[model samples]
Target: MISKDTVKEIKILALHIRMETMKAIGNLGFGHIGGALSITDTIAALYGGAMKYDPKNPQWEQRDWLVCSKGHAGPAIYSALALKGFFPVEELLTLNKPGTNLPSHCDRNLTKGIDMTTGSLGQGASLAVGVALGHKLDGRDNFTYLILGDGEIQEGQVWEAVLFAAQKKLDHLITFVDYNKKQLDGYTKDINDVGDIKSKFEAFGWHGQEIDGSNVIEIIEAIENAKQHKDKPSVIVLHTIKGKGWAFAEQELFNHHMNISRDQMEEALTVLSAELEGLVKE
Candidate 1:
């Protein structure tokens, strides 16, 4: 279990990743701002407080695996990876550039720390489950973390993955669903109501928990609790605001899947700076 100090570290790492995300995409001039921002806290909990990884050996056999089910949010993952020293922080500026390895979607083969190439939504969740099963079969003490968007759940495959994980009793897998209520088009309710993802997972024989995705402490505890329930895979439904820290961006649906404008970039940095200060106090 993580102590107060570890929880503090998670918050600090979250703030740093959130800031790095804004700066990285700010350099790219645009990217999936809303979704990336929404999952920053979970990313922090995983990278800083949960996952075991090495900067020098990203492909280490015992390293915990992370699959970005909402692959467009690769910016957040990249930021965390860079901060964890998987790569030089300067490379973040080259994100989405024609020649850069970092594309709009995460490609595991291309990026050092990414475990799966995931852009097609629901498939990544299934892939993460597969990795967990592989670990279990090999008798390796590794965990698999999969981060999915609420919109991504619209895909039929995601439910299939959820059912499969539960049926197989893949306890090593912990899935986080970004239940921000917004998707690419608009609110998730407007797009295609994903009716009670928690209940759905529970019905499918999985252990489901609801959490405030933006809360670092809640994220850490929920995941840790899920880890202990070995009868089934755990699914955490995280209630979050799409553009978590940016007020203007949060209100605009179009901002859910947009690049940063020059003015927006400045505003993002300002908000991030304030958030960083707040995190330091924790």
Candidate 2:
């Protein structure tokens, strides 16, 4: 178990992830705000407190892997990677820029710390399972972590991957479902409802748990518990709020995807700056 000091460290890192992400979106003026905000705590727990990675050599053979299945949240992942020293944070402004390596979707070959090129929705989760399996087969001790959007669970491929992970007993793999309950079109209930993902993964042979995705301490605990299982993949279905932090966006319907208007950008900046005032780095 992690000590209280370590838990504090995790919270600090999560706040920084949100800070940098808000700044990046503020720069872009508009992007995948909801998904980006929802995944901040998960990114923090992995990059800051859990995963083993080197800022200078992201492809180090012994490094633990991270796959952002909900790739639209690449902005948030980029924020954490930069803060973790994977690359210079200033390069974030070039996000989605023409000819820039940082596209809206993550590309492992292009981004120093990114382990997979993902934006195809349900694929990254499955890919993480594959990575874990490969490591296990090779007799390596590394772990694979992945995050998925609740809406993406509607895809058929995700279930196939779930079954595969369970049957293969890929215990080295862990996945988190960002249960923000809203997608691009509208609330998930109005769209194709994804019945309880926790129950689904559990039924398919996973050790499943649910937690508040925004809480760093709970997420860290979930990861710790997940690592203890020896014969089943573990999953934490994270309940979250779409467009969290920025109240205006948080209250908006379909904050799933949004464009930042000039006025809205100013408002978001004001709110984020206010939120950042007391955050300290560990």
Candidate 3:
């Protein structure tokens, strides 16, 4: 179980992720806002305490690995890494700019803490499976965590990787599906829905569960449960809001990729700043 102090810490980290992500995207006045913000809590849950790593030695052997298969959410991962001391928080503003390490999509070669370079949808699943199997082969207990988008799973490559992961009994591989219900052009339900992802993963011979994606305690508890079960890989279906923590984006129908004007960004920040202040004071 997650301790009270740990929960508070996660909450703080989640706020930082949200703020930095907004600031980074707000710098360019546009980005994949909806998806980037959606995974904030999950990213916080991992970096807050769940994952092991040394910012100074990002490639530490004993460290846990994360694959953000939904690579467009690079801003959120970048924010978490920066907050964790992987790099200067100021560099976050360089996102997607020429010669900058933080690209629009995650690139291991460019970023300090990124494990596998991921941009193409569903490809991260394959890379994550390989990372887990490699660890198992080398007799390492490190866990490989993967985050997939609900829309990304529509690709056949994701299913192939899922089948392979279960076949290998990769118990160390934990996958989180960001089921925010919105895709780029339309709602997931209206645009080729993969109904019941948890059951689908279970049918493929993996332990799967669905949970409230934005809840820090539930997210941590679910991760603990996934770690406890040893046999096949585990998949957690995160029922999340597409644009969580941001008022304007939350109500947008086509929020997958949208423009973030300065006023809109600051509006979101005002709300976040107040909550962050309250949390810190508590």
Candidate 4:
């Protein structure tokens, strides 16, 4: 079990990721907010505690790697990276602007901390598996983590990578499925219901677990459990709420991507600031 103080710190970090992500997206007036918000807590869990990385030396040979297969959630990762000192926090305001390092999708070439350039769905899954395998071949103990969207599993190539990871027994590879239920157009049930994500991964020879993605404690515990199993890769199905931290966006039908006016941004910022203050007071 994680200590109370560590849990509190993780919660604070998650809130910071959410606040910074909102600021970054709000700067552009619009972005893929729903998916980005859903994955903030998980990113916080990894960057804030579980993962081994160096902000000043992002390419350090001994550090672990992260590949966000759901690349549209790049804003959340950027927020965490900046907060961790991979770049200046002020740089987050330049997301997607001309010549900015942060883009709509994660690009290792452009960003300091991003491990792999991943925009096309299913491709990052493959890249993550290869990286994990490469690390194993080199006798390195570092782990490679990947985050995938619920809708992204519709791609056949993702399964191919899944099969390969199992065959190679990449025990150091960990994956998370942000099962937020909604995709860009509509709910996953209406579009393509990837039935029982955890069960499907288990069938594909992965050690699978499902947990509340928004809860930092559950996210941390799941990673701890995944570390105990050594025969196969692990996948944590993160049941999350799309647009989790924003009330208006959570209720909007088309929250996947939309324009946010200055007033809306101000309202969100005010609410988030209050929440952060509450956490700090605690």
Candidate 5:
């Protein structure tokens, strides 16, 4: 079990991830806001607590791996990596710019800490399975974590990877489904409703559970449980609110990808700054 102080620290880290992600995308005036905000807490939990990685040695042989299937949420993971010293935090402002290492989608070749280049939705799942199986074959104990968007799961390849992971009994592989309910077009239900993601993973033979994605403590506990279950791969379905944290983005219906004016960006920064102040006081 994680200590209370550690939980508080992780929560602060999550807040930092949200603030940095907002700042990075706000610099561009627009990007994948909804999915990036939705996955901040989960990414924080992984990078701040669960995952064993070295920022100084990103290619450490024993370090764990992360494959972001919902690669559009790259900004959030980038924020975490930056805060953890994977690279200079100032580079976040250069997202998607000419000659910038930070592309709109994650590129392992370009980024220092990224394990795999991912942007094609369902493909990351398959790649994650391959990485996990390879680690197992090499007699390594490190876990390969995969984060998938709820909308991305509509692709058939995700199911194939799920089945293959279970068949191989890749117990060291842990997956998180960011079920934020909103995709780029609109709501997931309005686009393609994936009914009961937990049940689907369970039926596919994974040890699955559903949790509140924004709750840091729940995320830590769920990951701990997943680590304990050694007979099968584990999947956590995170029920989250898309465009979380920032008031304007959270309430906006079409916030999946948005053009943020100077005023809007200032408002978001103000709100997040106040949130950080409150957390630090606590």
Candidate 6:
């Protein structure tokens, strides 16, 4: 079981990721905030303690790898990486700028700790499966984590990868589906409903589970469960809200890719600051 103190730390880390992500995208004056913020908690859970990683040795052979299939959420990973010492925290503000290592999407060659580069939907799943199969064949126990956007699963390639992972019995490949209900065009349901995602994965021969993606404790515990299962790959459906942790963005239906005014960004930072203080004191 995770200690309460540890849970608090993870929670703080989640908030920090959200704040940093806002600052980074906000600095650009426009970026993928809604989708990015939705996965902050999951990223925090992974970087906080669920995943084994070394900031100084990012290429550590024993380390588990993360593939952000929904690559628009790169800022969230950048924020966590910076906070975990993968890079200077101040560099987060350089997101999407010229000559910046941090792009709007994740790129392994540019980023230090990113395992797989992704932007086009449904591709990360295949990359993650390949990595997991390779590690498993080498007798390595490190996990390959794949973070997929719910809407991205509409791609035929995603299901193809899902079938392949299950058939190979890549037990170490743990997948997270960000069911944020919104996508670029509009709400996922309105665009293309990937109905009953957990059921779909289970039918495809995966060990599937669902949980609150926003709660750090739940995310950590769910990951522990995913790690314990063997003989089949596991998929955790994370029910999340787009533009999560931000009061204004949460209410916007088309928050997928929206511009944040300077005033909105400052207000969000101020609110998060107080929330962080309260969490610390508690």
* The best candidate in terms of lDDT: 3
Candidate 4 CA-lDDT value:
0.93
Which of 1 and 6 is the better model by lDDT? 6
Report the candidate with higher TM-score, 2 versus 3.
3
Better candidate number, 1 or 5, judged by TM-score: 5
Give the TM-score comparing model 2 with the true structure, all chains together.
0.95
Q: State TM-scores per candidate.
A: 0.96, 0.95, 0.99, 0.99, 0.98, 0.99
List ranges where model 1 is wrong by over 4 Å: none
The model with the greater TM-score, 5 or 6, is: 6
> Considering only N, C-alpha and C atoms within 3 Å, which residue pairs clash in candidate 4?
none
Candidate 2 lDDT, 1-282, residue by residue in tens: 678777777667666777677667777777888899888878888887689999988889999998888889999899888998888989887888788777888998888889999999889977888899999999998999988899998988899999999999999899999999899999898889887889999999999999998888889889999999899999999999888777888899978777777677667667666655655432
Using TM-score as the yardstick, the better of models 1 and 2 is: 1
Q: Residues 1-282, candidate 5, lDDT per residue (tens digit)?
A: 689888888889988888888889988999998889989999999998799999999999999999998888899999999999999999999998999999989999999899999999999999999999999999999999999999999999999999999999999999999998877788889889998999999999999989999999999999999999987999999999889998788887787788887788788889888988998898
Q: Model 6 misses residue 54 by how many Å?
A: 0.5
Model 4: runs farther than 4 Å from truth?
none
Computed on alpha carbons, the lDDT of every model, listed in order, comes to 0.88, 0.85, 0.95, 0.93, 0.92, 0.94
lDDT of 1 by residue, 1-282 (tens): 568888888888887887888888877776888999899889988888678998899999988999998999899999999999999998998888888988889998899998899999899988998999999999997999999999899999998998889888999998999988888788889879997999999999989999888888888889889889887899999999888877777888776667678788888789778877876865
* Over 4 Å off, model 5: none
Candidate 1 at residue 187, lDDT?
81
Clashing pairs in 6: none
Q: Would you give me the overall lDDT of model 5? A: 0.92
| True lDDT of residue 30, candidate 1 | 69
